[model samples]
Target: MKAQGIEVLLVFDPANMNYLTGYDGWSFYVPQLIVVALAEPEPLWIGRGIDLNGARETTYVEDANLYAYSDRYVHHDHRHPMDFVAHILRERELDNARIGLDMDSYYFSARGYEVLRRQMPHASFIDVTRLVSGLRSIKSPQELEYMRQAGQIMQRVMKVALGNVEPGIRQCDAVGEIYRAQMRGTQAYGGDYPAIAPMLPTGRGTSTPHLTWTDKPFVREEACILELAAARYHYHCPMARTVFMGDPPKRLVDAAMIVADGVQAALDAVKPGATCEAIEAAWRSVTAPRGIVKESRIGYSMGLNYPPDWGEHTMSLRPGDRSVLEPGMTFHLIPGIWMDDWGVEISESFVVTADGYELLAPFPRKLFVKP
Candidate 1:
């Protein structure tokens, strides 16, 4: 908070709270937050009384710093938990201070903000949506280790997904195997639930992204794309690949090789002092020449996260994004090309190094074909 000149920071993003205080639980469904003031050494965690035990168990802070409201505030029409938070801030004389709130955060509800605003009318609220997020962009050595473990889990999960997808096999059956592998994870480590579910889009659905699986059985001469992630200690590594059940189409086959080459070229461009825009340019140079123009940003920063998405919402590997690359920064390079008929996505999760980028997974960088 001092580095950003923020006097008091109200962290409503669960990921930010987790990063700051090691407080982790399924309490984001409620109005919970971590309050940080420059003068205080430890952050204050507040939430429902029922979840107070979770905060104590997961966090390393002193018990005195934790506060809990009554269960009456859960869905109370007249009461809000922020009202109690404002009372604490007032006690600390922060009601008139410059307070930073994660206004754009998913966990920070519109009603929560309004209640806090009314409760602390004299306080000046600053839009510090990415304040803590910027600090989390770079991974520490321990954080990288967790991500590597997650990558190992993904390798096994992908293997199950690749093996079970076949003709006459229901999409849900293959997804079931993927789920089982995710739960079982690697031999050395167990898996945590990913931020997003597995995306198994086949045939026409592959033309569009973000579609989930169906009970429909696979057929001959069709394409299926698997985009899955594995989590270890809430650190994520997302990997995706497209597969063909039978003799794949010549056009898709050719596109697959081109996409593979483009991804490698982009990976090679990852070095310290390089710009994010330059990396996207390297990938586009290969595909644009072939008349393939992808409108979406190629990649984004990735790290510890909760459900709904795994992206860090910090930097994008695309034009207009001049965020300079630094060592320890991690990104998910999603070099996907979606045409009117079909789409191909072969991606990687990598960490930026001094010399180049290191891929999190040891999986092959080519499309998978099962005959």
Candidate 2:
């Protein structure tokens, strides 16, 4: 803030709030935020009165710094939570301060911004959407450990998903098992709810990504894609794989091999000084020779996030990114090929090491073919 000349910072992203104050709750559905003033000793937590206890329990914030509005402000046509927020700013003598706002966060609604802008017309708001997220690009030792644990849980989750998906099994039922394994986790520890739901795109649905499952039964010779993740204390490790119910087509097997090899080459290129685009270029070097033309990015920075996305919204492993890889940076390299009628996704999560890279999700890199 001192460098950016921001006297105040309004944090609206739930993940950012969690990262800052350890304030974890389901209160992000309504309006809630953390106010950081340069002159203040500690950040202030503001939200609904109903969630006040939740903030007190989860956050290390002092009771005096915790502020809450009445229930009447929730969902009311005329009464908005930002009005209360603006009032707090006035009380702090920061109504005219230069504030930084996370304008692009999923939780920062237009209505909330409009209300704040109108209520505090004297204050100048700057867009610092990527400021906090950029700081999260590198992981600490504890953060890396949590993500490693999440990867272990993710391996089990993928195993359950692969085992349940076979000829004649309902897609929805298979997804149910996947969800069970994701939450049940390993006996040593438990799993937290991931940011995204279990995506079980089966058969023709595999042609596109992000499709949820239905009650339809799996058929022979069709491909099924499982894109899932497991979280430990909100740290995530996402993995993806393709499954063939019966005798796999030659094209599918060959494509899977290409993807696996390409991902390996990409991981091999990861190091402290390498650029993000270098990894994508390594994968493209292998795939392009095999007539594979993928326009989408191969991977992205990911960790410590909430619903709607687990991606860090920072560096991306694709052409023109040019962001230099660091030792503690982590990424999910999911190179999925979507054809007109079928698709295959083979992915891996890894952390950049001083020498190279270490795979987080320790799973087989081949397509599973069930006879």
Candidate 3:
């Protein structure tokens, strides 16, 4: 925040709220707010009375302010949630201060922005989404532990999924089986999004990277690509593997091998001084000449959330993105080879280290063939 000249960073989006407060509640539907006053002693959390206790217990924030709204009654017309936010800022004498707002982080309704603008007309609202994103790119020890647990859960789920792969099984059936296996007998299993349905794309459907599960039955010699996420500790790690039903075609096997090699190349390129674009380029070098056009980034930062604060949504395998690789940075290195008939996707979760990178998920990169 100091690097960006942001003295105060206020977050209201559910993901950012969770990142700041560590309070993962359904108050996302309500007016749950988190204010990080860097200059102050500690952060302030505001939420409904129902979520107060949970916020106090779960969140790292020590000082919490609770608000109770009437169920069947009408209160002061000026007691709306946005009004409360504005009141808090005013009470802190931050009306004219340069306040940073995460434009991409929070999904404020037009009414909410209008209320804020009207209330603090003198305050300078600057977009510090990138600043917050940069901060989130580097994971803390606790965040890394959560992500490691997420990777472990993904490995378990992948094992269950690969074991169930067989000829004549419907794609949806396999998906349902994986979800059941991952979600059973665990409380913190499916983090924020409880159910992450696996994508079992058979044959030509594997050509498309993000193929939806279909009713098509697995056929002999057809490639079955499974993509799934295991949600644990509110963090998710996406794992994908391509397998064949019968004796695999040599071309498919070779292509899958190339994709796996590309992932290794990308991981090998990860170090403290490497740029994001360069790391992606290294992965492409391993597969591009082998008739594979790299469609997307090789990887991106991961954290206590899936599609976390720092994601590959905007910054991608393009020029001018020189995000320096740093220790504690986690990324999903998904390198694939898209062929005319079939495709191969080998993805793994990795954490950047001082010298190199460490694979978080311990799943096999080899293509699994089920008889």
Candidate 4:
């Protein structure tokens, strides 16, 4: 924050909230925040009175740093919960400080920012959404263990989910099987809820990358793109593959080979001194000659996340992203292509190693063509 000239930070991103204090809950439906100031001994957690205990139970911080507002502030059209947070900031003598707000995050609602801006006229607010996000790009040993566990869970999940796919099974039923594997995890440990649910888009529906599953039955020759993550303690390991009900056409097989080769080239490009864009360029070099010009990014930095997203919004494996590769930084390298009539996704979640990068899950990186 000192680099950004931000003396006080108001963090509303749930992933960041979890990173800073280990506070976890589904209470993001309403207003809540984490306040960080230079002079403060501990960051403060402020939220609804009903959920204050939820914070206390989840966070390692002392009870003295927890503050809550009454229920009247919740769901009120005119009244907002951030007003209470602003009041506390003033009481703590941070009202006139150079405040920073996480304005670009999914959880930092416009109404919340408006209220904070109106409440603190004397304070300077700068957009610092990516400040904390950048700090979490590199994983510690413990965080890597949790991600490795998540990867193990995903390997089992992919095995069970793809094994159950057939011509007549409902897409929802297949997704249900994936969910079971996710919840059951390994026999050693249980799984945690994922940031996003199973994205098992079937048939030509795969052309749209983000569609959820439907109740429709799979037909012969149809394809399903399985985009899913198995999380352990909120650290996500996403895996994706294209599964076909019958013998896939040669076009798909060729595309699958291209994607796999491209992903490998990208992985080989990852090292301590490589740039993010250079890694993407390595993937692009393999596919560009095949007339596969993908506009979407092939990979991104990822780690601990919340609902609706699993990416660590700081860096991208794309053009102009100068962020150098570092050991222990994790990424989801998605060499997915959604053409007009078909789509194929064979992806990897990996962490940067001393020599190169390590794949989080050892699942086969191939398009599954089955009976």
Candidate with maximal lDDT: 2
lDDT of 1 by residue, 1-371 (tens): 66666799999888999999998988898889999888788889988899999998999878988989988888889998888888888887878888998788998888888998999888888888788899999999999999999999999999899999898999999999998988788778899989999998899888987999999999888999999999998899999999998898888988889888889889999999999999999999988898667889999999999988899998999999999999999999998888887989999999999899899987987778888
How many steric clashes between backbone atoms does each model show?
0, 0, 0, 0
Instruction: Write the residue-wise lDDT of candidate 4 on 1-371 in tens digits.
Output: 89999899988889999999998999988888899999898999998898888998999878888999989998898999988888999999989989988788877788888898899999888988789988999999999999999999999999998887788888888888999999899999889999998897788788888999788888898898989999999999999999988888888888998999999999989999899999999999998898677888888999999988999888899999999989999999997899887999999999999989899998888889886
RMSD of 3: 3.9
- Kindly give the stretch of ten consecutive residues in candidate 3 with the minimal lDDT sum: 67-76
Worst 10 residues of 1 by lDDT: 1-10
lDDT of each: 0.90, 0.92, 0.70, 0.90
The estimated TM-scores of all candidates read: 0.97, 0.98, 0.83, 0.98
Q: What is the C-alpha lDDT profile of model 2 across 1-371, one tens digit per residue?
A: 88887999999988899999999987789999999999899999999999999999999999999999999999999989999999999998988999999899888889989999999999999998888888898999999999999999999999899999988999888988988988888898889999999987888889898998889889988889999999999999999999998898888999999999999999989999999999999999999999887999999999999998999998989999999999889999999999998889999999998899888888999999999
Positional deviation of 221 in candidate 4, in angstroms?
1.3
